[model samples]
Target: MATFIIEGGHQLKGSIQPQGAKNEALQILCAVLLTPETVTIHNIPDIIDVNKLISLLEKLGVKIHKIGSGSYTFKADEVNMKYLESPEFKEDGKGLRGSIMIVGPLLARFGKGYIPKPGGDKIGRRRLDTHFEGFINLGAKFRYNREDHFYGVEADRLKGAYMLLDEASVTGTANIVMAAVLAEGTTTIYNAACEPYLQQLCKMLNRMGAKISGVGSNMLRIEGVDSLGGTDHKMLPDMIEIGSWIGLAAMTKSELTIKNVSWDDLGQIPDVFRKLGITIERKGEDIYIPAHKEGYEIQSYIDGSILTVADAPWPGFTPDLLSIVLVIATQARGAVLVHQKMFESRLFFVDKLIDMGAKIILCDPHRATVIGHDFKSSLKATTMTSPDIRAGVSLLIAALSAKGSSTIHNIEQIDRGYERIDERLRAIGAKITRVN
Candidate 1:
């Protein structure tokens, strides 16, 4: 396993650019299977999860060409349909959770799709019921192989229908939208996930000849088209990475500029950090975070109650960045309550932070109360293992702000999301090294 040895207490400088959105890239890459024409995608992040999905598509006979550093052209002119049922595919498909998305486009265009039980972060139970149920609502037959832990959906022809999702799952909404775009009639999806990335997917599909409306709302209407054509699409900069950088700057007292962040799309992220008493300045499209030399403070509610930072659907704070927020709060001026509503196991990483001398109370599996050390006490470095991608990056941030050198094992989890993180941190005066 790869590890990161970080020299702590160093302040980072200069500017860092966020990579293409990993979540969006997964959906966009799967959409390429909807058309036989070349779909040129720009700003594709070179990360493990996204790359795994691309390789999975390539193995399924999608022709992929590298056009530039972060650009690729994909054409699914001759997809190997039988490959989906092969042993090699079952192994590959189970490696990443994003591989589940390919089933939608495949089932849409070819009338059938199959996937092994998808694997991803063990943060919590992420059920696939939303995806399969949506497909079933669209006139697809669903079957599961309990022995093999496999799922399959097939239909001779899909007929659109109205669906009110039990939950506004981002991937689930994306999958259903992809399937409905090629159905026989109009499809209406209420309670859809309206995150910016999902909106990007809808817009891209529109460019590819799929009729979709309500691009940025919870209700999505899609008028099915006979076929979709290929088009060029560019991915938005990863908002989660941008939030991480913000938290990193505050934790290490660094003056850093995060370049080319699409500010308009970063809903509630800046405000939530500001409530933690971090200074975030907008310089056109870039986010300039000044050094919190005196340490930041947490704000209380108007009624003078303790502040609570919780994750909800979009237009609210993202759950992915809660780990970062929790880590940064360790050195802030006051206390804050972080409630992770979506995932049960995400807060389990607080024990590692507590080992480093941070004042945190693991209230339960869903909540934690972080009392800021206020920089009067620096965290003592220690060796640890990464639990998941978000938690791994959070640990890396904690190590960077600690008093001595720290070692993090199983850094492959971090690499799955961030692109060349060590190299990028090194450029910004961070003393981070990747050890094999």
Candidate 2:
């Protein structure tokens, strides 16, 4: 297991670049299976989860070539369909939540798809019913094997139909869109996730000869086509990482510039931080956060209620950055409530912050109330373990602003999302070292 030993109280300055979106990369990488022709993807983040998914695709006989750093050309001319039924494939597929997306493109092209029980961070119950139900709505026969703990979907030919999703799931929308592109008729999806990730997927599919309308709304209409070709797609910068950097700059009193951020695509992220009284300067496509010598303060509602930051669907605050927001709130001038509606256990990591001398009230599994210390007392670093990818980075940010050296174990969780995070932080004058 890898760990990060961070020396706190150092002000980080200069500019840093965010990696390509990890969530979008998972969907785009899996979408490569939809076409037999070569598809080139640029700005691919060199992260563990993405590399694992790429390896899984290679094992399934997709021809992958590394054209350049952060770029790849993939051709699915010959897919090893038989490997889907193998014990080893099941074991490997079960280890990644993104692996479930492969089932969509596989079913669209080959009329069959199989996946073992998928695994990811133990944040909460991440159900696959959304993905499977979307497939079944598209005329695929779905089955769950209780004994082996696997899911399978097959059809002679898929005929598109209307679907109203119970929840606007991001990966679920991507999977269904991939499946519907090659179906026999038009498919209408209501209450779909319209995040930038999904919008990019629709654009990429359109470039590949799939007709999808409503790119930035909840309603998506996909006109089924005979087959899809190939196209090059570039991933947007990671919005979650950008938000994390904003929080890091505020907490550490650092003046930092985040370069090449897709500013227009990041809806409500900057404003949400600004509500916490952080100064955000938009210079062209870049975001500049000035050092806060007096520290940040949380803004209350219009009626003088304590401010509340909650996660909602796209166009609202992202749940992924709530952890970072919570960490930053610890040093702010006022109190705020963080409500994590999607996941049940994500806020559990606040206990570690409490250990670091922050005033936090874990109201429940879903909500936390943070009373700002206003930099009157600095966080005292201690040994801790990373629980998930987002929480790991949030904790790292906290450790960077703490009073002493902090050791964060299980940094492999951090590496799963962020690419060369220590290297990137070091470029901006952060004192972080990676250890085995």
Candidate 3:
């Protein structure tokens, strides 16, 4: 395992570019299986999870070629369906959550798909009922094998129908959309996830000859098509990484410019941070966060109560950045309550912050109360373990703003989402070293 030894108390001041969206890359990469032609994708992030998915695809007989840096051309001309039943394939599929998406495209084109119990961050109970439910609504037969802990869906010919999702799940919507594109009739999805990731997926599918409407709303319409073709696509910048960088700048009192962030796609992210009294400026497509040497103050609600930041569906705050928000709040001037509604265990990382001399109350598994230090007392260095991808980056940010050096073990969690993170931070004057 690799560990990150971070020297704290340095301000990072340089421009950094956000990589392609990891969430979008997962959906787009799996969507490649929907067509037999060559699909070229640009701005793909070279991260662990994505590379694992690509390797899984290759195992299933997809022709992959590296065209350039962060670009690839995938040809699924002849997928080996027999590979899906192999133990090696099942093991590979169980390693990443994104592997669940391959089921949609495989079922759409080959009439069947199989997946082992998927694995990802242990932040909470991530159920697959939504994905399987959507498939069942689209005239597919769903089966689960308890002995092997596998899920399978098969359909002779899918016929589209209306579906009202219980919740707007991002991955579930992507999977269903991929399945519905090649169905026999029109499909209507209500209360679907309308995040930028889903919007980009719809646009990419449209370019590839799939008829889909409602690109930026919760209601989506899709007219089934005979087949899809090859297309070129460029992914948007990673919103989570941009938000993390914003938090890092605020906590460390630095001036950092994030280049070419899709300004329109970052819904409510900047505004949420601004509520914590961080100065964020939009210079063209870039975001500039100025130093907060005097420290920031948490803003209360209009009715004069304690401020609360909670996660909701798209157009609301994303759950992924709540960890960053909690970390940065440790240095603010006032107290704020962070409510993580989606995941129960994500807030458990606050215990590590409390050990670093911050005042935090872990109210429960879902909520935390942070009383800002206001720079009156600097955070003392400590050893910690990264629980998940978001929490890992959050701890790294905290360590950077601490009084002394800190060591974070299990940094592989951070690398799964952020590409060359230590190297990227080093470019911007962050004192982080990766040691094995």
Candidate 4:
């Protein structure tokens, strides 16, 4: 097992850049299956989840070549879409949630696809019925194998129709969108999960000649085409990483500038943090963070009531960053309710911060209020293991700014999203070491 030994209390002093978005990368990789030409994707993060997905693609005869750092050229010509039936495929698919994306391209290319129950952070009930149902609406047949805990679906050719998802599930929406892009006739996805990740996928599909409108809205209209050709694309910068770095710099009392951020994509984030008294200055494509901005105060409402930070779908605060926002709020002045409606288990990480001498109220599984900017004297270092990706990175930030030395195990979870986090953090004066 690997663990990160971090000695806290030193303010980070340098700049760091995060890799591309993992969520977008997963979908983009699978979108390659829609074409038989060489598709090049730039700024691909070398994370485990991506590697697993790439491995699956390779097993199915998708020839992938490393063009340069954080870039790949994928050729899906002569790809065997039948690898979905292999035992190894089922095992790999069950271990990662992104594997569900295969259903879309497979159903489009081979008229059938099989996937086991997808696995990811055990945060709450994530249903794939919406995905299968969307396919069924497009005239696909689905069968469940309870013995193997898998799903088998096939169709002569998917004919697109209207699809209203049960919820705005991220991966589910992406899967259905991919299927509809090449299906016959026009498709409309209402109440879709149009996060930046999904928007990137939409833009990429459009670039590949799939007609999709409503890039950042709830309703997406896709004109299904006969076939999609290859395209060169660079993923937008990671918004979650940018937000995390903002939180980390504020918590550790550092001055840093995050460059290459897509300012247009980060709607409501600056204003959201301004409510918490965090000052952010934007210069062109870069955002500058104030050094030692520890007096982050929670602004009251127009009626002078305490502010509340909650997560909703896109154009609202993202559920993925709720944990980091909660962690940062622990060091901000005043109090705010951090409501995470998407996942029940996301709030469970409060125990680690509570152990760090921070004042936190665990209201329940979905809500918590953080009273901040008041450190309870000394915070003795302790050992903790990461549970999930976002919570894991938030804990790492907390450990880096806390007093004394702390050990964080299960760093694999953190690596699943963030690329070369230790090196990036170290470049910014964070004292972290990986030990076997």
Give the root-mean-square deviation of each candidate in angstroms: 0.5, 0.6, 0.7, 1.3
Candidate 2 residue runs with Cα over 4 Å from true position: none
lDDT of 2 by residue, 214-330 (tens): 999999999999999999999999999999999999999999999999999999999999999899999999999999999988999999999999999998899999999999999
Residue pairs of candidate 1 with colliding backbone atoms = none
* C-alpha lDDT of candidate 1 relative to the true structure: 0.96
lDDT of each candidate versus the true structure: 0.96, 0.96, 0.95, 0.86
lDDT string for model 1 (124-180, tens) is 999999999999999999999999999999998899999999999999999999999
Question: To one decimal, what is the Cα RMSD in angstroms of model 1 from the true structure?
Answer: 0.5
lDDT-superior candidate, 1 or 3: 1
Clashing pairs in model 3?
none
Error of 1 at 165 (Å): 0.2
* Model 4 bad stretches (over 4 Å): 375-379
Could you tell which candidate, 2 or 4, scores higher by lDDT? 2
C-alpha positional error of residue 169 in candidate 1 after TM-score superposition, expressed in Å: 0.4
By summed lDDT, the worst window of 10 consecutive residues in model 4 runs over: 373-382
lDDT of 2: 0.96
Candidate 3 residues 1-436, lDDT tens each?
A: 9999999999889999999999999999999999999999999999999999999999999999999999999999999999999999888899999999999999999999999999999998999999999999999999999998999999999999999999899999999999999999999999999999999999999999999998899999999999999999999999999999999999899999999999999999999999999999999999998888889999999998999999999999999999999999999999999999999999999889999999999999999999999988888899999999999999999999997889999999999999999999999999999999
Candidate 4 lDDT (Cα, 0 to 1): 0.86
Better of 3 and 4 by TM-score: 3
184-219, model 4: which lDDT tens digit per residue? 998998989988889989999898989999988989
